[model samples]
Target: MAYAADFYIQENIIGYTGDSQNKPTVYFRSGHKFGRITQAYPDSNYQGRSLVREYTDYSISNRPPKGTAEEYYNGEVRHCSRYPFIPVDDNDSLKAVLAIAIASYPYKKPIYSK
Candidate 1:
């Protein structure tokens, strides 16, 4: 099955905003079983000053369950929502990618180094 972490990564990239450079937003979506990465951009906006926002609709598994902050910090549950940045930047989306990459040992792949 597609790892919940992968979905989390894709969602973060889709919603990422790189300062205000107007750089093209990038995202990665992995298949449930094969674990492949797909890139897509539903919509992007750059209002100058390096302010950018990307939007997409995706769901992830391995996320921390909703609860009070105390519950999460205490290690009561794995709250994915609490950790938005996993593989990449500490944004809501990158967290999933980070987790999946680490768990799958995809770091060996040269794609990330580039």
Candidate 2:
């Protein structure tokens, strides 16, 4: 499975959800730096550090009991619901993808520089 963090870099997507549709908007850039992924309401005015905190919170599993924030964000990414950059044909496929991402997170090997 691809590392969950790599999804951003692989897709090269950057934007917040659209105000009305909640559909994601794409503002393309040549490259991207993978960071945290989390939910931010369309109306929310999320600052840089706030976004970072959300990402960290999601990463550490400090989200709602209903589900982890990271999972929800990943679902959005997986489905291309909020963001159209990632393509997924159905919810089942997204779920399977999420399961793999979650399963892979804890066991991911660390990269060490030579």
Q: What is the lDDT of residue 83 in candidate 2?
A: 30
Q: Which stretches of candidate 2 lie over 4 Å from their true place?
A: 1-10, 14-21, 24-32, 35-44, 47-64, 71-114
lDDT of candidates 1 onward, in order: 0.29, 0.27
Per residue, candidate 1 scores C-alpha lDDT tens digits across 2-113 of 2334343434332222221233222234332212221222322211111111223233333335321111222243223222322244455444533333233322223332
**How does candidate 2 score on lDDT?**
0.27
Instruction: Give the per-residue lDDT of model 2 (tens digit) for 14-102.
Output: 33323312222212122222332223334433211111112221211223343322222332331122332332233333333322222
What lDDT is reached at residue 45 by model 2? 37
Number of colliding residue pairs in model 1: 20
